[model samples]
Target: MQSNGPLYLLHQGQVVKFGFRVERRHVNPMDNLHGGMMASFCDMLLPLSVYRKDSAVGPRFLPTISLQIDYLAPAPLGCWVEGEAELLRATRSLVFAQGLVRADGVLCARVSGVFKIGPEFTPETAKP
Candidate 1:
């Protein structure tokens, strides 16, 4: 499991949807969803989005080079958080993506990321 989250794959073909429930551990001191957790969720969302589209060939192993998250609102605990991502661009060695995180129908965060899509991620070249 690449993610520590209880994330689930919703629609895996064209548009990728990943969702999870906000638990107590995901909150901050004020009982709002932690920014770090939200950023982590976005990190997972982007790569999964890229891989879902390229599934016919194989799983795409993308490592984040840069990730940016914009916090728009707070997500209370016990809310259902859904992440949807779009592949903005793909080059020979990089992939760019952006998405949104919505909790209980309210937009809570927006995220964009750049990922490296090269040999380092492949099983043959990865170090164990």
Candidate 2:
């Protein structure tokens, strides 16, 4: 379960920074972070971002309903990729957020996603 990353938070509060260390496995044949891994990283990052802001209720799963990514540049292997997400809007049942991933201060990708939220996401309802 920890395989996707040793993803760690740079700050412990609502506005958070997540950093991922680029490894050989995360690269494409061209030696850049793979597109799929970037997408997966965004998928994982957004929810964690949402959770950070909502941690007062304990963590809840924000199941992504839609996700879009714009690859601006290739993140070379051995670089530390970092990104931050903010909750843009939230309704009774859905939440929206956007984020950017960068390497060496260069934008690597931009991502935005919508997630479903409700009682189904409550901590007690979460599957172990």
TM-score of each: 0.86, 0.87
Each candidate's clash count: 0, 0
Candidate 2 clashes: the total is: 0
Per-residue lDDT of 1-128 in model 2, one digit per residue for the tens? 27778887876655688888889999999989999989988998787887787653226667889999999999999999999888888877788989999987899999999998744365667665
Residue 125 local lDDT, model 2:
72
Best by TM-score: 2
User: Which run of 10 residues does model 2 get worst, by summed lDDT?
Assistant: 53-62
TM-score, structure 2 vs. true: 0.87
